[model samples]
Target chain A: MQQIINFFIKNSTKLLFLLLLVISFGLIIQTHTFHQSSFISSANGVTGYVYENVNNFKEYMHLKTENDALVLENAYLKSIAYNNTSVKDSVEIKNLMPAERQEYSIIVAKVIRNTFNTKENYLTIKGGDKQGIQSDMGVINSNGVIGIIEKTSKNYSTVQSILNVKSKINAKIKGSNHFGTLQWDGKNTGYVNLSDIPRLAEIYKGDTIVTGGISKIFPENIPIGVIEKAYTNETSNYFTISVRLFNDMTNLGYIYVIKNKDIEEINQLEAETKDE
Target chain B: MNSVAFSNIARFIALLIAQILIFNNIDLFGFINPFPYILFIILFPTDNNKPIFYLASFTLGIIVDMFENSGGIHAAASLILAFARPSILKFSFGISYQYHNLNIIKKVTKDIFTSLEVFGYITISVVIHHIVLFGLEFFRFNFIWEILLRTILTTVTTLLTCILILYLIKPSKK
Candidate 1:
């Protein structure tokens, strides 16, 4: 009614501000870690669909670069399959006595948007649900592991970039067998920090880091990075080791997202054991 | 009800399309993502009711959310900027500047204080948006330092991109 209009006109700015503030705060709360509302994920779907197409076009632009990566990785993989058994032996060999080994299928896909500079860095891949791409598939470049697939639509998937704080990969030193978790400081592009390496172990600089194979997420022996610096912190028992990542995470064009065929089985077993 | 209002709406839709679809998806340098859709907010018709303006900004953010499928982070961030716009205006400019329906063109070219105030408002909003968006995305306080660095660098690039677009269009600044 005219009364409503008059009332609105009287305190329009204040009311509008309050309304927006409420909606925004609602969204923030809805998106907050404490509250896992379905709204944010649904909105991500809309945003995802739109970006999906745009990523398609932009990914096309990087076709040549991605093509180069695919070709190179293919050649290297082919050589490993045919000639280099010793190098490949360590990766394929499984330890029955140890934790479950995940068998992963690596598929080469183009990177559309690989934003490493941002705190919550994400990488978009050309493959998606149609390609059998699923969430939690490990993403890696030629030199090392990069990220994990967080979401999947029809023809595209978004990988939670290694730069993301939410992302972690179980990793360890190649020879020393010092196991730790690799996580980004959310700062540097090519550098991430290794946490939980026991202080008692004699750690050294320049040690090559590889996936720990502890969890069934990634296959063991996948290269992650090289230790740039190692120092024990007084505050914590874990040695804080800086890793200079082998893959140029910032310039990634094409990466192979590895799907571990055994993850479900292993997870099922783990869940059963934990429940017991 | 002038066609200019409709034209502005169309412009907003088009720019947003270009921004999320074209600009944001680009891996220009890995970490540097410069979203230019905020220009829509800076260019929104000021003749409408303030609450309606907030709704419009929220809708704009919803559109972005729909495409990114990131829940309501964009809407959340845009609404915050829209809410903060008035306070930013008051704080940056003197008491006199708040009273009049200032001319957008004159504010840009003739008034240096107006220009600075406008720029200042945008810079703060951009920073605030990134902080909230990234912070919520992580959903944790453990990576605070990484979040800070990313916010600062991305904000710098976004600010530069905003200024570049503004200078290019040279829209009558309000």
Candidate 2:
């Protein structure tokens, strides 16, 4: 027993380092696995509070630009509202009527902290469980698709920005049923790669891309980006296309968190099918 | 001794706040993030209380990770840096590192260390930190080029910023 004590005393510094290293690696695993229980995320209260105060101060600097964006968005929304026949012709009107029945609702939130330089970027916004924001909800600003919420505390949530290398979203070319997976290469902040797009689908450099909506997270046909480049690879038959995002992700301000009301129903039905 | 401990605590908090608020947001030349916060680990006393130094480094890394929303990559890198500090000091300071009271910042201000020794120390430390940080972040051998590019770019940026900070806050000669 004394020998073991002596061994520990002799190597305590190394032991302590190994112990801390193990804990840090465990945290990395937990965080990467998409588990919701991790404690060290920005969604936690103390960091969230600090970011909120900083955001409150920083918001003043961007007030003029923010107002200009709001006015532009308001004009666009008003144009849609005035064109009654055009609004009725859209797919959203069809979904709102009978079968789908308003499955998605938007909750307004302010971006408290945003980072895009890292390989895995995240945004902390000023709404959480208290504001009906939850994990895995789609987040977007007025311009276009932004990201998905990954964690939430009492008054804040952290979003897995589309710029993150780990981010994968279902996207489709506008006006066609062809679907692809949107992912970031951690290279340019303004671009994302859309893969698994079949070879036969017609595409152009400026063709618009929109959300596929196959998942319960985002509504269908929300604008994502325009194709910046596309080419077929020798290794695979599918085309790898580069998309330029509509939103200037580096300059985000306010955003909307989408809550899908039919998520529980869809998940239960899928689980039941899998079990069968 | 108490005042030394207190000043260390103050420096820790100050560097962390500066990192999370200003440095992280700088977005220099559009993507180079200067993480001078490792200065906490760099400037820590090289005397006794080795275990406390390791713990403090881990705590600083974890807190920075919390603010950045990166899972423990910062913690792992900072811990590695802290564990490797003694060898780094020995290599940079040569024979002078045998003295327990050797202070890099003080010695630099007092001209005990030539600018090359100080530069080498900061360069080695910052490069190691960035390599470990970006390596775990990319987490793929195929991204070795990306990792190397980022490591070099961020190291240069961080080294310049750290040296400037060292000059700004070097302790006065008694």
Candidate 3:
């Protein structure tokens, strides 16, 4: 026993290093596998509560700025509502009967907790299941698509912000029919990358980008950004385009959760196709 | 209770509040968010009991997890830190971590080595927390490179933050 103890004492440093390495590696594997990280989902739910409380105070600090921005956005949208001249043809109206050319619904919610720092940014809105918000519900600011609902609790729901790397939306270059997948590049919160646009298309810097009606996450032709730069890749068929994101992801406050009455059918059809 | 106990509690609460509120909002270069809360974990006096140390760190970490919205990531990381801390302390003192001899912080020890050791251990553990966090949030192998980059960047930012916080949360003499 004494000899064993002596040997153990001498080799302890190597053992400690191995132990920490193993623990960390195990965490990496567990974290990498989705099945193992469900623990994280429940834990995030807990954080959901904590941020909900903390943001109550924190959100107030940004209230004046948010309120001012909200007012400006409200006025801007009001202008769009009254005058539809500059509004292009692609902005789809969901509730449009033949009698109504354009129709829309807007639900108001305040940003409780906003974390744009992480790669997967999240916004905790002061609305929830009871407030008619559910998972996969589309969210937007006056700028463009903010995010979709990732998790929902009783009084609050978390939106996957446009700044998140997990967020992807189909968008097209303004004036050109070519569309590409838009995703956050994980470098700048205010910018995202538009990939898969055909290189042959008439593309240049400063051209506007807008959402394609390809997905239910956002409506068609919603203004996304202006092309910051565009270049062809080794895979020569596509243009790797960079876009200056429309929304100021860092300072998101008041948002509208756009519940499309037809989204259920849209997602259902996609899910069936995916299964097939 | 001793003044140090109160100070420890105060430090814990202050660090938690700062991390969840202030640092959470900061995103420089996108992947970095330095967690200063572990400064509280690092500053607990060597004379403090191991159980209390573990309990305090775990509780603080759990509270943080509640805010990060990632399940068990914070708690698991804190517990991992707590579990590994004694071993780290043992390595610092160049001795075994038996309970009876635990208060032997009076002995002259490796000051520089200990600080770096603690920093390395805590940084690695926090990286574990974040890797679990971002990885789960984006469940795909395609994001492996991004996740690793984010963890590294965030760890660097957090370490700078931890060092700055250490300057503020000084150990009070009994």
Highest TM-score: give the candidate number: 2
Pairs that clash in candidate 3: A40-B71, A43-B71, A44-B69, A44-B70, A44-B71, A47-B66, A47-B67, B34-B158
State in Å the error of residue B17, model 3.
Answer: 4.3
The residue-level lDDT of candidate 2 at B145 comes to: 92
The residue-by-residue lDDT of candidate 1 on A95-194, one tens digit each, is 7435454356778887655556545556767778878888888888787888888777777777777877667789988866778888887667879999
Q: For model 3, state the Cα shift of residue A271 in Å.
A: 6.1
Q: Which candidate ranks first by DockQ, i.e. highest?
A: 2
Q: lDDT of each prediction vs. the true structure?
A: 0.71, 0.88, 0.68
Candidate 1, residues B3-115, lDDT tens digits: the string is 76786788678878777766665555565567778767665544545676788788887777644545567776777777666666566555555457754433542443356
lDDT of 2: 0.88
Candidate 3: stretches off by over 4 Å: A1-53, A59-64, A81-104, A267-276, B1-18, B22-32, B39-63, B70-76, B96-100, B104-174
TM for every model, in the order presented, reads: 0.76, 0.93, 0.71
Kindly give the stretch of ten consecutive residues in candidate 3 chain B with the minimal lDDT sum.
B104-113
Candidate order, lDDT descending: 2, 1, 3
lDDT of 3 by residue, B30-78 (tens): 5467777766755567663555666676567656755664444555566
* Candidate 2 error regions (>4 Å): A33-38, A85-100, B112-115, B171-174
RMSD of 2: 2.8
TM-score of 3: 0.71
lDDT of 3 at A60: 66
